[model samples]
Target: MNGMTRIEFLLRLTISNPDVHTAIIGTLNPDHLKTNIAAVAAGPLPTELYTEISDRLAKFSQPK
Candidate 1:
């Protein structure tokens, strides 16, 4: 999935705000899309952190 897309942000936002109920039924559908992205933000754990940590440990091997 393209991380830069609004859809990705919307999906993440929805997951984060599951309790924000709305009277507008259509707004809750999976097809609902966000054009303005003032609310969506990247998650707390950046994806690059995991990759960097894994790369740093690539040389370590446990004894058999």
Candidate 2:
């Protein structure tokens, strides 16, 4: 949702949690692997961004 790419956001989301130590991503294409590497190197999302994402998911994923 921020300036980060969708892949970056997803990876950073996974990396943000203290309980999470590893995230496995599979790819066949070289470019995809490169993008994934860059995403991981970008590191975890900021606390505010992570909380905003979790909050949005909780809000929208509720039964309507």
Candidate 3:
């Protein structure tokens, strides 16, 4: 979704799952790396935000 940021997206993929041990991101640019680090520093998304994202994704996945 356009409203989701890189950090939120990353955390959503990693933090939501207990079996996931790590998430690897590839980036060559310094600025992009910094942003990615900051995203991880922000930690996992709150339950409300996660639920919202899940709901949005569910809607998006449905047949149009």
Candidate 4:
């Protein structure tokens, strides 16, 4: 989404919350660490995208 790499998009999702202080991710691989750093550099998703994702998730999680 938003033409960003999947890692970037997922990292953005992980860090979007103000209440979230830290992220726990696999850090065993040196290359993975570099990828995580790059993803964080890309920052969070746009507000519109975040809101949309939240809304969709809420609906999805509702009893059907």
lDDT of 4: 0.85
Global lDDT of model 1? 0.43
- How do all the candidates rank in terms of TM-score, highest first? 4, 2, 3, 1
lDDT tens digits by residue: candidate 3, 1-64: 3466866576555777566887787879999888777767766667776677778779979987
Off by over 4 Å in 3: 1-4, 55-64
Task: Give all TM-scores, in the order shown.
Answer: 0.25, 0.77, 0.59, 0.79
For residues 1-64, write the lDDT of model 2, one tens digit per residue: 6888888888989998787988889999999999989988888888998888889889988998
Worst 10 residues of 1 by lDDT: 36-45
Tens digits of per-residue lDDT for model 4 on 1-64?
Answer: 8888788788889898676898888878999889888889878778999999889889979988
Comparing 1 and 2 by TM-score, which wins? 2
CA RMSD per model (angstroms): 12.7, 2.2, 3.9, 1.7
Estimate, for each residue in 1-64, the C-alpha lDDT of model 1 and write its tens digit.
3454655444444534435554232355444434322224454224564345445656575345
The TM-score between candidate 2 and the true structure equals 0.77
Q: Where does candidate 2 have its weakest 10-residue lDDT segment?
A: 1-10
